[model samples]
Target: MGSNRTNFRVIGLFLLLISMLLFAGGCNNKNNVLSAKQLTDNTPLTVKVLDVGQGDAILIRGGGQVILIDTGDVPDRDKLVSFLKSEKITTIDKLIITHPHADHLGGFAALVGQFAIKQIIDSGQITTTALFRQYLTAAQKKQIAFTVASEGDQFDLGSGILLRVLAPGKPLLTGTDSDLNNNSIVLRLTFGKFSMLFAGDAEQVEETQILKKYSREMKSTVLKVGHHGSRTSSSLPFLAAVAPEAAVISVGLNNDYHHPHPSILKRYEKQKTTVFRTDLHGTVTIAINGENYTIMREKGENAK
Candidate 1:
């Protein structure tokens, strides 16, 4: 009788262990797969790379949050405000000014009162430009929380989406033609299996630094071409490290500086990267659903 009881107890314990393993397996499977309905739900992460001529302005909306990256040039102030209004964006949860460049943050002062801004993020680097000071003064007057971004800083945009800073390391880099450009806030946003890198005017030095520190994390689905696809920004090593499937260059049509140098275009073509330019494709929008994403353009042929 005693032996029989011991045998029964052992068998029951074994069954319990098997049941636990099966339950864990089921949970893993559920997490690994998503139904078509879930993937095609009404809400999906949307990133709008606004066509602010010769400047950078990207609007990201997801998980009940809205983030504005840059404000573009002074002339784009009305355009940016109108676009935000059209989207029914009453408040900006996070406003990231990559740098103080006129074409990047020039419209910031004018936009200070446009939206109910929660926080303002800037690269710690300082400049004496009048535009920069104006932006700073406006932020102060508004009493918006200011944050200086650093490498490894992460901003949670909910729904498992995270924006991580990869550049402007501590102590600030120097010796570059434009330290502000090189120190631009480099951010990488990841949503499930999808990822996009916003390389804010980062040049070779900044790229090399980031590569040395975060080589594994550099690969992304989309890349915002640095410095409007300037030869000085996207070096061969940088391109190899990023390995972006798609590239977007925010440049004006037929403006001075002859932006998006032909050689740079050739480099992207060699990599077989689908290149889209703001000049060519106005306001490129990428709607992300789980690991899948759809790229839409406002206008023009998809090109260099």
Candidate 2:
């Protein structure tokens, strides 16, 4: 009788352990399945240019799709992910790698693992970095849709918001010292009569090329200052061509680059352009409705 009781107790314990394991596995599976479903569900469109300091990460939402342009540096990945979660963005509809530079694409690998990415738009080819290689490998393994975006490529971002690619036009010049920055993807976003230009670190060389191609149509309401306001970028001729009413520069506070170069700021001042910067004021958001728009700083301070 004693032996039979002991055997029964052991069987009960084993059954309990198996039951607990099954329960835990089921929960994990359910959570993953739910997360996958969330990726496909449509969400309202909104654009947020996160303040990752000296790095760029623009979030565009519309038509139930969330598009992220650049992912900032590697150290800021957790902050970027948290910000997205706070905004209830469970998936990234499109991820645009404006360029291969570390500041632009460093956080990409971390993000790819955390979110469901539907498609990726890059300038075509990799520039050979550990991070870049990791991004490429993950992209391949996940079978994420990839495209080499260039001039004239247009896509909708829900509710009449349209993004048009406007740079890195044909031939894809390589082997030049300025190739990386010059090849940055420039995007023009149009919503009704309000439009903004996001030139991803495109310096004078690329700007001159862009002007030659789209001189008449470069005017915009908001300009995301290129190259972190580097003297090599945002040239006077380019500024005149863009003629943006307001400009935002994403740069780190007291950065080594000494961005928002004095000359560039003076030019903007001369043009009477309203300038806002991330290093000083934090995240800057511009919202457009028809032909009108409003600029809001994270700290609720008036942008200079």
Please name the candidate that would achieve the greatest TM-score relative to the true structure.
1
Which residue segments of model 2 deviate by more than 4 Å? 1-45, 300-304
Q: Write one digit per residue (lDDT tens) for candidate 2, span 136-238.
A: 8999999999999988899888688889888898877566557988889999888877788999989888898899989999998789999888999998899
Q: Candidate 1's residue-wise lDDT over 2-109, tens digit each?
A: 999999999999999999998888556622433344444354698889999999999999878999999999988898999999998899999999988999997787
Q: After superposition, how far is residue 271 of candidate 1 from its true place, in Å?
A: 0.2
lDDT of residue 88 for candidate 2: 80
What does the lDDT come to for candidate 1? Answer: 0.88
What CA root-mean-square deviation does each model show from the true structure? 12.2, 18.7
Give the top-scoring candidate (lDDT): 1
Error of 1 at 199 (Å): 0.2
lDDT values, one for every candidate = 0.88, 0.82
